[model samples]
Target: MLNLTLSTSSYFILGSYVHIGSLKYLYFMLTAMLYIVIFIVNISLIVVICMNRSLHEPMYLFLCSLFVNELYGSTGLFPFLLVQILSDIHTVSAPLCFLQIFCVYTYVNIEICNLAVMSYDRYLAIYCPLQYNTLMTFNKAVIFIAVIWFYSFVKFLITLSLNIRLTFCGNVINSVICHNYLVVKLACSDTRVNNIYGLFGTVLSILVPLLPIIFSYMEIFKVCFSGCKQTRQKAVSTCTPHLASLLNFSFGCCFEIIQSRFDMTSVPRLLRIILSLYFAIIQPLLNPIMFGLQMSKIRNTCKRVFCYKMLTRHKDTM
Candidate 1:
């Protein structure tokens, strides 16, 4: 379950063993289907945003970026895991393994910054609605997003460079995804500096985004609660999803980073498996649903996209 914790040794979940049983096979099929469904939904969102002028605002632009991020982020690991789980061979080469690590970590780091930036944008929109359009201009948003990608690239490069200095004499990783802590642990060299920097990095990455989210909601609550009945209802309806996502995603990060420093052997492997699935897979999958499902326009756009082809086919048959 927690076998993904190893770093330096090549491993295969032998078919004769726990890796390829009936239950595991079912899990693979389900995960693949889930990934396909979510990817399609995110793609539909991209198409809708691209074609619709009404969604040309900064908020919608941010949403489009999010759809792309999730699509790529999930794409990097999900399919590979699916194939590995199904195939007899579970081993990956050194270069491909490193690349997979880079892709998964980089996109996730970008997502962290994007969420923070989006939260800031929301703060301005709700807290300073009259000046939001001027403050979060189209050009400014474009710059912010560009910076996000640049920052992610630089961060991953630094982290990967540090890891590469150490030799992986053995080829072992315990999880489906090459988890960050496992990578650090697998390094044949000392990771003292890396460990210290990692601590600071974790705090900065999690807290920087979360602090603003906390304050943003504080202000939102103050403003929304102070309003009259109808206004309060309207504000609550709008803010609920953002607040829930902020809490859930922030909690996932905290648990992942903070607890990873402890001894893995002490914890039950089943528990660790639960945590990994929750933090890595489920949290990213939920973001679009949490934010986008509430929007009437997006749902309608999705319905039209799906039905358009079917309707045309039916008309031709008639």
Candidate 2:
């Protein structure tokens, strides 16, 4: 029988890292580069949205929030990953592990909620264009963003509090990062409350955001089908990137959930690692690229900003 009480100073061993001899350095470099790219691109878009008066609308405000969340999510994972990749000992202190859990859970919750709110914002812009200004004022947009962040933080705080009371039988985690589900599974103490709350939390997390996304898209599709070619074009142009982002993130999350909850022993280690990292790595990188390239307004603003800087620099040199 495993111990029912865990010491405060106890640490967790991450068991998922495969020894690749000198390849670990190569992996570290690639991860560092990826993090740098994610940071630069997300920051650039955030700056573009913030500095431009034209992007002061509710839609762009939502995008700014999205970009910020990408930075938050990636920072929570990448730096820790970089450290772990180089470390011969794959151990994390309990406090740090719990902290990572909080960060990651809150990030996921905020992301889903943010996307849900953005979907609703799009619905208003397309479905009620004339009334959008009244319906989703700048103040209202700020409130929505604040509420999404607050809700996610509070929700996970409760989950973390519940989890902290558990006594762990073991300290080995089977994945590359600190995961909530895997941690809960290690508890030697009774986890009925945790289990119940986790199930409830999972449902709420998914349905709360998912319902709005579905409703918003359904409404959007209705308008696209019934309305003229212009409206259809408008819907496609605005919604396509969002849809892509949402689906990509959702699929990544699904894979993560399935892998965590079920047996994946038959899956190849390399593929498992890639799929596990998909949501964290890809979404943060993809969002800025998708929105930056696909949205004409943002693309134009970026060009103008770059060109203006170059011209000013030339004048200074002369």
Candidate 3:
């Protein structure tokens, strides 16, 4: 057993791996492909939204923000994860591990809050069409985006500070991803303070944005049912994408929370790896596909962007 306290720069063993001794290259290739696809899709959506003037609306702006957040979240994990997969030893430096914890959690918090903001945007568009423009102006959209990131960092910083104070006895992180809660468990000291703060932080993070999302969706549904067919169609077209993204992310978050908090040691190590990676790998890929398929404006814009790129490539070749 390695004594973590004696050396501040000790590494942590990432203890999640499946038996694939000969298939390491294959594993690396598949993982790299997924990460690359995630990057391309999210970046494409962001570019399509930003380059088109028609997509400058509040709803699209929020989508762009979500894409950016997804990119932020994915970059935090995939780069490090991809590198780790190629190496024989699965270890992360102490500083790098903590940094990953911050980046991953902050991404999650911002994601939920961004979804809440999108829900609110939908509520305003359907419930108060007249005020929607005034309420969700471009400047306000920017501010909301800023708040989503700022608030997430501020709240998580408290938990991270508490975590920094705890002294660790062990350095083995029993999962693929570096989670703050799991890191807290490695500490040798009394973790009551860390646990209390963690619980408070977790609840605060979830409830603050989650309640607003539920309320906004409730109001949106009420309006959709009572309003005209056109209104109903508009509501469905716009809100469905956000709702799908929310449900997908919510399930992933719930699974992660359950896995992290409870004892699931009997579960197969492969299953555990999948559970840990689902949110990090899946949600980022899903968001663009959901929006691209569901939102006509985005779909149309993407088509145009692709066509333009193809034309340019042909011209260059000729």
Candidate 4:
């Protein structure tokens, strides 16, 4: 029988009390709150997009998709982590391990495609405003969303099948959640096939999505200056948030692809934590904030959310 022993040390790879002292606990706690805030905000945005007729445009639709992606990203990583923070038994079953890693990857891949698709939507709106309606019709947007899900699911099945064939031999995982790279690293059997797939998957997830974003913005810039000054301001505000998000998201993919080679270095532990926080944690949190800041429509919708809730509460008293 596979020994399934669990421990506080085994699961919470970065423990609150681990030689780092109480600060680690505070670190994990604050980030956990960020995850919760992000989840709620994104879900709320999704509802607004669905209910508000004015938001039925291609851009808002794409924004809603991104909000959903952020929601999933936060959900996949944080709840298990929150439980680990508060509970004594912090380990996950090997099967559950597979599932957690799988979901994280699936959503992440979907988000990459969604960003690319969003960039295309922007390209159509800005690059060919007259044809934007015919170019990115609602049906095309729906099909694009479906393709994102399907593509990611296929990759998940491929990676999962290849990973399941390996032998764990022991039950210890160093990460708080089931991290895919870390898991494959622990496999006792040959994982060259899995590693190759990992490499390909990384390129698809990062570079494939990256190309259109760069190209789209390049075109956007060309056309922006050719129009009114108002167009230039709108272009900068809109593109800035998306650019920040794409860069931050790419940081994880870049790190993961090369992480195995770097773990042995004399790099300080603090730097690793900062990178993980910025790439994995803060990036998702930043998306909703970026949308709220740059997109006046989303910001107004968010404000209406609070006012709507308060009005309902007042009516209940009456």
User: Whole-model lDDT for model 1 versus the true structure?
Assistant: 0.70
Q: How many residue pairs clash in all the candidates, one count each?
A: 13, 0, 0, 0
Could you tell me which 10 consecutive residues in candidate 3 have the lowest summed lDDT? 1-10
Which should have the higher lDDT, number 1 or number 2? 2
lDDT of 4: 0.73
Model 4, span 1-318: residue lDDT tens:
333332112331322213444565786688677877887777877888898888888788778878887777777777766666565555666666777777888878887788898887788877887898999988888888888888898989788777766765455554445777877776677889999999998878877777988899889989887988887876787778888887778776566445434552465555543554354567677887787778888778778888999999999999
lDDT of each: 0.70, 0.91, 0.84, 0.73
Candidate with maximal lDDT: 2
lDDT score, candidate 2: 0.91
Comparing 2 with 3 on TM-score, the higher-scoring candidate is 2
TM value for model 3: 0.93
**Worst lDDT 10-window in candidate 2:** 1-10
Rank by TM-score, descending? Answer: 2, 3, 1, 4
Q: How many backbone overlaps does candidate 3 show?
A: 0
Q: Superpose all Cα atoms of candidate 4 onto the true structure and report the RMSD in Å to 1 decimal.
A: 4.2
Best-fitting candidate, scored by TM-score: 2
Q: Which stretches of candidate 2 lie over 4 Å from their true place?
A: 1-9
